[model samples]
Structure formats: structure tokens, C-alpha cells
Target: MLEKIFKLSENKTDVKTEVLAGITTFMTMAYILAVNPSILSAAGMDSGAVFTATALAAFVGTLLMAVLANYPFALAPGMGLNAYFAYTVVIGMGYSWEYALTAVFAEGIIFILLSVTNVREAIFNAIPKNLKSAVSVGIGLFIAFVGLQNAHIVMGGATLVELFSVDGYNKLNGVNATMNDVGITVLLAIIGILITGWLVVKNVKGNILWGILITWAIGIVCQFVGIYVPNAEVGCFSLLPDFSHGLSIPSIAPIFCKLQFKGIFTLDFVVILCAFLFVDLFDTIGTLVGVSSKAGMLDKEGKLPKIKGALLADALATTAGAVLGTSTTTTFVESASGVSEGGRTGLTAVTTAILFGLALFLSPIFLAIPSFATAPALIIVGLYMMTNITNIDFDDLSEAIPCYVCIIAMPFFYSISEGISMGIITYVVLNLLTGKAKEKKLSLLMYILAILFVLKYAFL
Candidate 1:
């Protein structure tokens, strides 16, 4: 049946290799199980509920990708997108988590409409090639910055970045930096990064999963030795699980179907919605092209067969994710791991979906994996994404300036949407000013989007 459905022989992959590849892909990205809840909980959402939502969304999304798209990709609540939902929309904008979810749901529906109309393809092509690469690199930098902050590897203050100091006692002064201003938390994070980085360099499969497990075990030992504290406010060392409940189902009632449509109609909300829409649109396209290229699925013209089906799966996943109480669901670039492991068809996706479903039962134990342990995975993934920068042509100042701004703005401004908006605006304005727009023959939609983005920043 697997061979019949996935055409394993035609794809030159067998069931066993596909299954192993699926597991490899899942292991490479499973840090989402721990990291999503940690980030969303800051926005006042229930941590346990987010954990269940994240897993269930991945299961359903990956299954949809398998059955509908016949691809070896896995879907999850995207890392940077989740941070935006929690930090930018809910916390920074002072909106309720429910309203933030509404934006995502609305964005997803629009994405579905665009995909069905094939308008999304036009927009994807409208983006300058260099800017597309820059978006990926910028998102990578943003994710890495978040990981460093989560691990307390970079001290937070008014400065853009800084190091911890063994200064005062209370929160007013600073976190108590230990052992010559270098604490156990810092050491653990460094060790995790070194271990994971080395594994990746040595071409080890499941390197990220191994890194998280080893770091988590070391943290547990530190807790037993009284070096790692459970709930510290300032520095790292929060290794304890907040709940001891076992085997009970997580309640999604607080978040499920709680989207606020009325709240999504405001000017700021509309801007926010546009941000989600564009980010998801480009992110999905980039990942599809990238992973397919690695799998040799792209044609000589760089076109991916069955791309519409893949994109539809992503659009549906985003809609479903919002209804299930999480962030945007999109194809993970970590699917490259599965492809490198020799997965070539839908069976690999099916295997991953099954694993995601099984994770729901292990939520009790997995939720205990702290942010510090997972930080290394995010940083490593970020570094992996930076490879896309090589695709950008840096000789043209018109392209290079926009790409540079896009890459730097994501981490500095703390929003992927902000980076994308600024990049598009800069791309259009600079090209037009330099008389290159006519030579390049910029798209009508590009000019319109650039104008809209300018208006959004100026007034909205």
C-alpha cells in the first residue's frame, strides 16, 4: 500500500529508508515541542495547552502535506512566526492572545484565497531574488538572537547586546553572575552549542535531537546538585517543570476558536494581518523551492512539480493551526534532513505525522525540556539558514542595500514583518530613484505593496 500510494519504486526509495528519514527529520526539529510553549506562555497563554496545540498541529499539518501534496516535508508552528504572535502581537501591541490568533486565522484564509487564485505565485515571482534570500537570512538572525536571549548567553538591557556581570543581588541591579561572572547556565548553553555544532560538522544524523537530550540531562543533574534553579527571573537555570500532571489531555478550551474578528478590523490589526500574510507566503515558497532543489525535484527551469498542491497544504495548515490555538503552520526547512537521509515521497511525511501524534502522550516528560537546552537547536538551525545568503547577488547596490537592510532589520527591529516591509519599500524606492526600476521592469504589485508598506509605517 505504501508503495502504491507513494510510488516508492519510481522515487527510488524504499519503505525502510523513508521511515528512517522521517524520523530523522522529526528529530532534527522536535525542539518545537519545548520551545513553542516557552515562548507563547509569555503572552499569557497556557503552556500545557500550547504544547498540545503545537504537537497536534504538526501531526495534522504533516499528514495533510503527505496525503495532498505527496511530499516528504513536515509542517509545524513556525518558530519566528510563533515569537511574533506572542511577543509582537500580544505583548508589544497590547492585544489579547485571542486577537493575535484572529490575525493569523484571517491571514490564513487570505493565503488560501491567494493560493487558489494563483495570485500567490505572482507575488512570489514579484519579489526580487536577492530580497527573498535576504528574508531567510534575516529570519535566521532573528531566531538566533532569540535563542541567545532565552539561554541568557547575552545579557539584556538598554544596549542592543551585552554580557552578564556579577554585580548586585536583586533584579534592579543584575542577575548574580557566578564563578567570575560566568555562571552554570552560561556554561551549559556553551556546551550544548559546541556539542550540537560539532555533531553537525561531523555529518551526524539527528544531531539536534541528541544535543537537546544531552543538554537536558546535564541540566537535570545540575538541578540535583543545586546549581540550576527552577524559576529564576533574571539569569538561566530554570530547569524545573511547572506541572507534575501525567497522562492527562491538555485543555485547549481557553484558546480554541477564541479568535476576535471584530478586533482584526482595526488599522493596526490590518497592518499586522498583512505582515503575517506576506511572511507566510514568502516563507512557504522559499522553503518549497529550497527543499525541492535539494531533493532534485526541481526541473531545469527551477520549477517544482505539484507546487500548487504543496502550497495549498501549507495554506490549509495555517488555517487549521489558528483554529487549534497556535501560530502559522508552514513547511520546515529541516525537511532537508529527511531528503539528505534519502526520503523521496509521501511515506516519509506519513511517518513524521505519526511521530507527532505519539508525542502528545509524552507531553508530560517532554515539556520538562527547558529553553536553555533547546536554545542550541535554534542557534544551529539559524546558522544553517545563513547559507542562503550565498544565493544573493551583492554586486548591484540596488539589490544589496535592500538585502542588507532586510537581513539586519529582522533581529534589530524584532519583527520579521518589519524587515520584509522595509526591504520591499527600499527595493522599490531605490530602484525607481536610480532609474533601475524601468530597466528591471518592476512588477505593478511590487510598487503597490511598497506604497502600502510606506503608508502603514507613516500612519498606521
Candidate 2:
């Protein structure tokens, strides 16, 4: 049955394997719906709507990808872009939630154009394979870095040189405070990490089960000790949105009455928009290429299978997310894990999508799952993503420099787009300086992205 459904490179597997694989992929990718919205909600504009829209649209859009694109790759609102959507638009620039939505829509349009034209893939051809691999490894390092920071295992201290503070007394201006909240946080984080690692290393099919079990155990213990992590938003139950009050741009006008065109022409906006565009383009391109390579989805030409059509799926996913209220579209790195389960066909995606749809009905159960608990899973998955970095040819300047740039810059800048933007700029200029530019196939899109990066760095 697995062979009938899945055309895997490896030999056939049982239905049980496919089911388990699908479930694992779903679990890993499910966080995007919850997390992307959570972070974007911080912007305090259209958050409720954005959250709802992102969830609903991502559900529908991802299903489309799963069924139509027929790959293990999962699509949803991405990492770096959501932060920008929240920070740059609604917070820093003080744009209305509507305009931010418009900006996203604009980018979505660009993405659709690029995909339909097959121009996006052409541009990505210039990226060295090693750099592509480096992106994966760099993402892994990123995840580990995030995990350490979140676990408070890595912290800053008061030495002239900062240090990771562990179990140190709370020194308050020459005074010792009796309370020690940091220690407790550290302990909880460790407990979560240890339990998660144990399950993963043990090859437990459902590692998240361990998270729930440990979380409950910790909760019970803390309750006995008169300590608790409250579910303030919902008392262990998720709330459904009153659709009458819910915002929907695709359905409603959304008060997009007048264009706030004043700041639109400014260099700041131009740089930011272009910066965002390039970041969106490359990150999505890189992820698709990486997952395609790992999933054995590469075509005879060494290009992603049905490259243009796949981009369309991604584009529609992004647009759907925007109307539903999220950031840009992106491919999930966790999709690679699904391949391990023999999930070679679109059925894997269908399984995942059905689960996501079911989740909407069981939102209450999901809401009960806390963010800190999920962080451990993300931290681990991030570790897995780092594996791609090792493929970079460290000896080649063209590949090595760009690879390193992307690896370090992403975590340092705390944004994937920023890292990608830095990388493309490096690739273009380095190739040009060495007179090796003529040797590589540089698309019009690449040139434009290269130029965008140059001016963005210069002004932004």
C-alpha cells in the first residue's frame, strides 16, 4: 500500500510507516500556524484577525500544496517575515494593519508573477549548491542557538566580558535577593530539553507526547509547590472566534479607503520593501531547492520538479495567508523529516492537511499546549536544519564566503531574510570582482535582487 501510494527511492514500507510519517510531519509543521500568529500578534494590530486569517488560510493553502504540489514540503507563514510584519510595519513604521496587509499582498503578487513566469527558479540557479547546503546547516546552528538562549543555558552576565549565568545568586546592587525565578526557569527548560532529547534519541515516533507528559508532570509538581504557569488567555480551553467580528479582507473592504502614499516613495520604504522582497524570494527559493534535493524531488535537470507549478502553490499559500492575516509565504525545513517516514506522495500532505483541519475543531485542546513546551520542539528541529550547512564546499571562495555569510548573519541578525539579503549581495559582488560573473548564469531577477541588496545595505 505504501509503495502504491508513495514512489520513494527506497523500497516499499507498510501503511503504518506512511501514517506515522505523515503524523510526524504534521506535528512538526503544525507549529507554524500557532507560532507565526503568536509572534505577529505582538504587533498589536490586526493580531486577532491576523491570527484567525493565518490559521484558516494557512490551513486551506497548505492543503492545496499537499494535494496539488504532491511533495512533503509544507507551506505557511515563514519565520523572518512575520517578525518584520509585526516590527517594521505595525510597530516601527506605524502603518495600519490594512496597509501592512497591502504590502504583503503586493509581495504576494510579485511572488505569483515570479512563479508563473518560472523566472524565480532561473534566478536561484546562480546559488552555489554548497551555499544551499550551508543554509541547512546554518539553520541548524540557528535553532540550537535559539534553544540555548530560550533555555537560559546561554545568558549574559556582569563581567566586563559577559558570561552564561547559571545558579548564581541574584545580586541586587550589593544586595542578595531571596527570590530565584531564573533558576526555576532554567530548571524547567532543562527538564523539557532532557525529556525531548530522550524521546528523539530513543526514536519515539511521537516525541511531542513526551512534551505533554513532562509538562503535565512539571505542572503537577509546581502546583504542589505553589508555583504555576497560567494559561491566562484561555483556562485550558481554546476560544473560537466570533466570525461576525472576525476580519476578512478577501471578503470585506477592510477600510482600505485611502492609500497612505506619503512614505511609499521614500528611500526608507523602498529599501525596506526591496530588502523584504529579496529576502522573501531567496529564502523561499533556497528552502524549496533544499527540501527538493533532500526529498528526492529533483527532476532530470537537477531542478525542482514542476518548479514553476510548485512556486505557484507557494504563492497562492502566501496570498491566502495575507488575506487571512499573516506574514509572507515560506517553505518549512521540517518537511525533510517526513521523507524518513516513507511519505513520498501527496497523500502524506493530505494526511497532514486533514489533521490541520481537524485541529480547527479541536482548537481548545491545542490552545492548552503552551508556547514554552513547543519551543523545545522548534529548538530540536532547528538542530536538524543545521545539517544542511555541512554540504558547503569550504575551499571555494564563491561558495564558502556566501555560505558563511548566510550562516553567521542569520543568527546574528536574528532574521533569515537579512541573512539571505546579505548573502545574495556577497554572491553578486564577489563573482563580479573575480570576473567569474560571466561564467555563471545570472538571471534578470538575480541582478535585480543583487542591486536591491546593494542599495538596501547602503541606505538601510
Candidate 3:
């Protein structure tokens, strides 16, 4: 049945491998189950309801990816988009959460139209092959930086960022943290990274999945022995899952289907909708390009087969997520963890979707998996994705310089879309000025994109 459904033999993968890949993907990205609710609640939404909405949105979106695209990708409320929804739109702009959601819903509708019209696929095909490779490498660095920050192995410092130090964290955050609360967990994360690296070197099956569970187990042991202490005020919590409240799903009635289109005709609403559309479009394209490239799923033309299905799935997921009462749902880059684990079919996405569905009822257990445990998986996956750098045409400065700019901008600017925007602009400008535009045969869509990005920076 699995073979018939996912063409497992054709993809050179089996059920065991795909399932493991799916679990690895879920473990790495499960942080969203906890994070989305926290961020959305800041926008005056109910946290419990948001948790339910997030889990349902992920389940619905990931399941759609499997059924529609048959690809090993997962979807959820995106990180940066959520922050903008909460902080910028709702709080900073003083708009109601309902109003913000209406913009996201409208953005999703536009994306669906774009996908149906093949505009998104055209943009994907229009990017230069070297820049596509650069996007993969850039995401590697971006996610690695994210892993470091998540584990508190990297923290804000006098010089902007620095290595983990107990005193430094204390001073920067104005909190009284100790080795038991902050220091030991960071040490464990470092150890987990080295251990996971060793497993990768030894060619262990399901190394990434095992790495997360092993890290969590070690934290549990540390907490048992008093080496690690749970400090609620400092964001540290018990490693053990708290099941005292029992297994029950939260109701989504509070925020579900609460869209407000009253003030959406204004300029401010258009800006918000455009922001969501721009970020979600590029981020999804960037992930599909990066992860698919690493998984060897792209054709010789540097394009993924059945890409319209993938884009349509993402488009539908974003629209569905808005209706479910969350921020923009998009393809998660952490799906690279699954691809690195040898996932090549929809079975992997189905497995991830099942986990998300289970999370609705088992929230405490899934949310108990801390960032420190998953951090190693992301760092290791980053290492895997970074190997794509060899595919770039370094001999050609016209290609190399923009690729370099794209690669550096992602982690430095802390945005995948920003990296792509800078890369496209630099790629078009450099090639045009150097008399290589005609030689490269850059498409008209590429020029339009560069101009659009330029206008985005100029005004928005």
C-alpha cells in the first residue's frame, strides 16, 4: 500500500526510512507547537485556543502537502510571520488580532491565485542555478544560527552576539541565572551536537531522531540529579512531561473563523497583506529549492518536478491556517532534517501530519521536548545542507559574488526572503552592468522581481 501510494521503490526509499525521516522532521520542528501559541497570545488571543489552532493548522497543512504534492515537506505557522503578526500588526500598529488575520487570509487567497496562474513556479524556474544553490547554503547558516540561539549557546552580547557564558547571559537579560538553570543546559546542547556529529560520522540510521531523544533523556537525568533545575522565571522548565491535567484537547472556539474585513480596504491593510505575501512566497520557494536540492529531487534544469502541486499545497495551507486562526502557514525549512534522513515520498509527510494530529490531544508530551534537544538536529542538518556549496560556480565572479551576498545575508539579516531579495537584485545588476545579461539569458521575470524587490525596500 505504501509503495503504491508514495512510489517508495522508485524513490529508492522504504517504509522504515520514510517513517524515521518523518519523526526526525517532527521532532526538529515541534517547537512550533509551543512557540506559536506564546507569540499569538501576545496579540490578545487565547493561548489555549491558539495552541489547538496551531496543532490543527499544522496537521491540516502537512496532510495537504502529502495528499496534494506527495512531497516530504511540513507546514506550520511560520516563525517570523508570527512575530510580525503579533508585534508589528496587532501590538505596534494597534490593530485588532481579527483585523490582522483578515490580511493573512487575503494574502493566502492571492497566493492561491498566483499558484494557479503558474506565477510562483515561474519565479522558481527563473532564478539562476547558482543562486538556488546559494539559497540552500544560506538556509544552512540561517538554521544553524537559529539552533545556536535556541539552545542559548549563542546570546546577545556587547558586540551583538557571543558564545554562551553564564555571566554574559545574566548581564544581557538582567536575570539571575546559574549553572543549574542556564549553564548546564547549554553544556548539554554542546555535548548533544558532538554526539550527534559522531553518529553522523559513523553513519548511523535515524541519527538525528536518536540525537533529539538522547539529549532529552540526558536532560531528564540532569534534572533528577539536581544538576539542572527548572526555573520558570528564566524560561527553563521541567524535562518531564506534566500529565497532571490529563489528556484533553483545547477548544479552538475562541479564535476560530474570527476574520475581520471591516478596515481591510485601507493602505495599512494592503501593506500588511503584501508583507505576508512577500515573505511567505519567497520563504516557501527558498525552502522547496534548498531542501529539494539537498535531497537530489531537482531535475537537471534545477527545478523540482511537480512543483505546481507543492506550491498549490503551500498556498492552500496558508489559506486554511488563516481560517483556523493562526499566522501565515508556510513550508518549514526544518523539513531539511527529514530530507537529510532519506525521506523521498509523501509517506514522510503523512507521518509528520499524524504526529501533529496526535499533538492536539497529547500537547503536554510533545511540547515537553525542549529546544535544547532539537537544537542539535537543526545544527547537524545545517551541516548537511551546507555541503551544497560545492555546487556553486565559484570560478564565475558574476555568479559567485551574488551567491556570496545571498549566503551571508540570510544569517546576518536573519531572513530567508531578505537573502533572496538581495541575491536577485545583485545578480541582475551585476550581470547587466558587466555585459553578461544577454549571455546569461536572464529572463524578463527576473528583471521584474529585482525591480519589485527594489521598490519593496524603497517604500515598505
Best by lDDT: 3
lDDT of 3 by residue, 1-460 (tens): 8899999999999999999999989887776776677568769998778888898889989998998889999998986677668766786678999998889899889889989899876765677889877877886787778778879999999889999999999999899999999899999999899888987788665577677778889999999999999998888999998788888787889999999989887756765775577667757987888899999999999988887888888888888988999999999988988999999999999999999898898776655777788788768867866887998999999999999998998788766666777998999999999999999999997798788778878876
User: What is the full ranking by TM-score, best candidate first?
Assistant: 1, 3, 2
Candidate 3 wrong stretches, greater than 4 Å? 1-51, 69-107, 202-206, 253-307, 325-352
* TM per prediction: 0.93, 0.74, 0.76
Candidate 1, residues 1-460, lDDT tens digits: the string is 8889999999999999999999999998787888888888889998889988999899989998998879999999997788778877887778898988889888889888888888999988887888888988998898898888777778655575676444422343544445422356667888999999999899887788788888988987887887766544454435555456767768877778878877555678877887788778778998889899989999889999888888888989899999999999999988999999999999999999999898888877677787778889889878977888999999988999999999999889888778888999999999988999989989998888888888888886
The lDDT values for all models are 0.84, 0.60, 0.84
lDDT score, candidate 1, position 53? 90
Count backbone overlaps in model 2: 8
- Collision count of model 1: 0
Model 3 poorest ten-residue lDDT run: 266-275
Candidate 1 local lDDT, residue 228? 66
